[model samples]
Target: MVRELFNSIAKRYDLVNRLTTLGLDKRWRRKACEIALTYVDVKKPRILDVACGTGDMIMCMRKRLERRGIPAKFYGLDCSERMLEIAKKKVPFAELKVGNAEEILFPDGSFDLVSVAFGLRNFSDREKAIGEIHRVLKRRGILLILEFSRSESLLGKLTWFYTRSVVPIIGGILTGNREAYNHLWRSIETFPSPEELSMEFEKRGFKVLTMEWFFPRIAFVMVLEKV
Candidate 1:
């Protein structure tokens, strides 16, 4: 279901993101990459990005690494082929595979860093997916996640309303698929809170390092380290 939904909207996925987030997602992705880069060794860092829609995270990290004169390997995994196809164009240097997040197909301790953006909430098995992420990371490896969380402030509430109403409509008009956009809103509303996600990370042998809200409290970036 999720794969089909993403495939349906793959053509306009980036557009919908820009429309929904008002282009602030690029800033958030940069921050996520920056946080992940802190733990990455400049010599030869191996990075994995799960559900890496359009490879924005990979591109962000790649640009940052290039600026610092560092060499790195990046792998992107996503279930949707169309999304991966688009990602391939954006990240020609990345090795992208069509794979499941719950069962990352890498050897143990294969990556120095792992990151996911706006994709966790759609996972059918969040715990298994997180465990797979932990399994693939080297000891003390860093994991960065960017996700939407329900906010309590008035501005957040207003933003939520706008997203709930506008996201599906704009997405539907662009993609000719309203149901997919509806699922997007529903998933965000049903996703667990930050406190709960922190506990989930701890259960999967990750210690919460830092958590910060961005985009007017509509979304968050979480940094965790494998214990």
Candidate 2:
């Protein structure tokens, strides 16, 4: 259901990401990558961005490192063909693949850093995907996860309301696909809590580092490393 929905909305996915976040998604993406970089030495480290819809996260990560005059081998993977197509056009040099996150073809320890932004929740079996992420990462490799959070603050609750309400409306108005944005909001709500997700990482052998909270209580930048 979500696959077809995303494939249908792929053409506008990047635009929605840019608009719905008030362009703040870019900052979050940078933070996620920064977390990944901290765990890996990058004289040309191998990196992969899973569920890399439209490759915005990859682009942001690239910019984060390029500013430091460092180079890294970057790959972007997604199941949505349309999304990959758009991402390729935007990031011509990135290695993009269409594959399932839970059943990736990459060999063990293929990448020194793996990051997934707004993608893990879409997995029907998130644990399987978590295992795959663990498998693909080198020993002590960093896995950076960015997702929607459930906020506990009064101001955070207000932000969550906007994310749940106004963001979708704005998304619908801008993308002409209210149902798709609606699906995204529903996915965010149904996703696991940060603690639960952290536990999943621990179960997969990743030691938790830190999770940074954004306005919407559910939005977070979580960093972990393989033990």
| Error at 69, model 1, angstroms | 1.3
Candidate with the greatest lDDT versus the true structure = 1
Q: What is the overall TM-score of model 2 with all chains considered together? A: 0.94
Q: How close to the true structure is residue 210 of candidate 2, measured as C-alpha lDDT?
A: 87
- Model 2 lDDT per residue over 133-163, tens place: 9999989888889888666788777887888
Best candidate per TM-score, number? 1
lDDT of 1 by residue, 118-167 (tens): 99998889989998999999999989999998888898898889878988
Model 2 has a clash total of 6
Backbone clashes (count) for model 1: 0
**Each model's lDDT:** 0.90, 0.83
* Clash pairs, model 2 backbone: 148-218, 149-217, 149-218, 149-219, 150-218, 151-217
